[model samples]
Target: MLTINVAFLLAVIVLVRLRRRTEARSRSDERFTVVIVLALGVLIAPTPVGEGIFDLLGQLASGITGASR
Candidate 1:
């Protein structure tokens, strides 16, 4: 749920920034960004590579929590 919410926030930020700028772009720009953002989501997900990162962070978090911190 939080992940979806964060994605929404990021999408809004992307749209808002693009909206604030004054420039003309081809349709491809929009399409490309859509694809790129989707790829970013996959990359951020807990795939093989991402899982290691998540595990490391989880360890850090457990340490910080220190038995119900």
Candidate 2:
């Protein structure tokens, strides 16, 4: 039996979609890409990788604020 992870598949799709030339994308194409990205975020948010990303972003935000002050 072979099972593919949906999040990984979506990530691949997002990569492929983004690789196209920016000038070639229409408004609807951009909207579709946004929807795909949001879906990917939702699928990944409960996993350990998502928690790590959250921590990393938090630290980055704090560092930026500290540097500004």
State TM-scores per candidate.
0.36, 0.98
Best by TM-score: 2
Query: Local distance difference test, per candidate?
Result: 0.68, 0.99
Itemize residue pairs with steric clashes in candidate 2. Answer: none
Give the number of the best model, judged by lDDT: 2
lDDT of 1 by residue, 2-36 (tens): 34655556666567647744466567877776775
Question: Could you tell me which 10 consecutive residues in candidate 1 have the lowest summed lDDT?
Answer: 1-10
Report the number of clashing residue pairs per model. Answer: 0, 0
Measured by TM-score, how close is model 1 to the native structure? 0.36
TM-score, cand. 2 vs. native: 0.98
Give the Cα RMSD of candidate 1.
Answer: 12.3
